[model samples]
Target: MQIKRKLTEREQKLLQILINERNKGIQEIAQLAKTDIHDLKTIIDSAIDELDLSFLNQNKEIDCTLISAYNEKLKNIEHAIDRLAEGNYGSCQKCGQPIPEKRLEALPFALYCVNCQKKKEEKNKEATQRSYPMREEI
Candidate 1:
């Protein structure tokens, strides 16, 4: 039988540092990593580049928008953390089903299972479309 590797203390420390220094400059994380500046810059730069590609498409003006989005995402994560502290993190918010441990491990901020999340997203999309329906010539 294969056992899953629980996140180690060192790994947890690294993750904590990374999360806390997310808004700080690369030099700070480099110092924490105990690595050379160039190597630290490369790691931070690559992560930022990947994030830009995914969220901002490298547009400088969209930085504020990305920040807002990130803020909202963080709020959700905070709510999840609150649930975790309350001993309710793994249950689906909508259906009360137990969220899989694998899913929770992959995304500690997740508040819903796949089905509940999809349903909520679909409902939100429908509401958005209804609120701003496109006009078509008949």
Candidate 2:
């Protein structure tokens, strides 16, 4: 069996950063969820009083989109925290290489190293291009 290495000072700092960011994200998501509920209540009241539905749908859609984004971000942060717990926070998920400290500082939730990330993005782009081929000029 392999032994786990002790966390360095920098790794400790990164763990703290991740924990702080996760807490902050949780608070933001909670606030967003509360606001969404309030907005829905207000939209229903306004729609009933004004007998108009245009604003209701638009407002709900925007709120849902915002909440969805926050939830996705929170998920990423949580995943990073899990990786940290697993003793592999700084390692790229795709290649098992350590991600640069600068990159981690900038994006604590990054799952891939720069090269791996680029490759993944390029592959995604090629797939998207294939699926949505441009039409010839009319």
Candidate 3:
């Protein structure tokens, strides 16, 4: 069996950053959960006063969106941690090249390097345009 290698300083730093980000996300979600419970109580009390329910519904929708966004960020951070454990955290998944240190520092959860990411975005944009063509003015 091969011996495991130690992580470099940069890798350790990246791992710390990912862990910090994950913790922050969890704390934010927990805070949001508490706020949601309070909001629900407020909504019930306000409904008894014949207040507008639509405003409460809008608030609920916004809370849901925030929760979803936080959950997605947490998932990405978890994936990055897993990749770091697998010894491929700083490599581009699409092109199989080492991702730039600056890019990784900016977005530790990035899967594709800059070029591959740009290409993927362009392709997605093209597909979106095709799916919803603009109408010509009459």
Candidate 4:
């Protein structure tokens, strides 16, 4: 019979810590997202009533930006929890590799390894650049 080796003490400890983080991240992010989103519409309406055209436009824009950011975080946090349940919490979704402990600790909801993350960022930058019109086309 092939016996599975046991995880080292440190690895076990790190797993427990990650599980804790996954739980806490889910709870905290859910609450934060709900609160932020709940007030978004009301805040934008208030800004329209209380501010001049320029300020109102800016305030509404800022409110939507914040809500979108929060929603992204909430989505990541929830997905992290799901990954933890699936026994792959610390693995990179893109590379199928274990994400570094430090990176996972710093961003429990991270979806990619460092190298993959860099690549993804580079691609995003390229896409952004391509979307802009050339001066002549403008």
TM-scores for all candidates? 0.42, 0.55, 0.58, 0.47
Candidate 2 global lDDT: 0.66
By TM-score: ranked, best first: 3, 2, 4, 1
Candidate 4 lDDT tens digits, 4-78: 445555445545665575345344433534535334434433542231223224443245444445445544544
Name the TM-score of candidate 2: 0.55
Per-model lDDT: 0.53, 0.66, 0.69, 0.56
Query: What digit string (tens of lDDT, one per residue) describes model 3 on residues 1-138?
Result: 121578787777777888787667766755765545455445433442232334434455347667667767776776677778768788888889988777877787788999999999999999998888878622
Error of 3 at 84 (Å): 0.5
Model 4, CA-based lDDT: 0.56
Q: Candidate 1 lDDT, tens digit per residue, 1-138?
A: 111445445334433433443434344433434446676455444554333323333445444454445544444544444444445556787899876666665665667999999999999999998888878622
Residue pairs in clash, model 1? none
Stretches > 4 Å off in candidate 2 = 1-5, 26-76, 134-138
Worst 10 residues of 3 by lDDT: 44-53
Off by over 4 Å in 1: 1-85
Q: What tens digits encode model 2's per-residue C-alpha lDDT throughout 24-100?
A: 65566446555454554454334422323344354453465665565566557666766676787898899999888
- Candidate 3 regions with alpha-carbon error over 4 angstroms: 1-5, 35-65, 127-138
Q: How far out, in Å, is residue 76 in model 3? A: 2.8
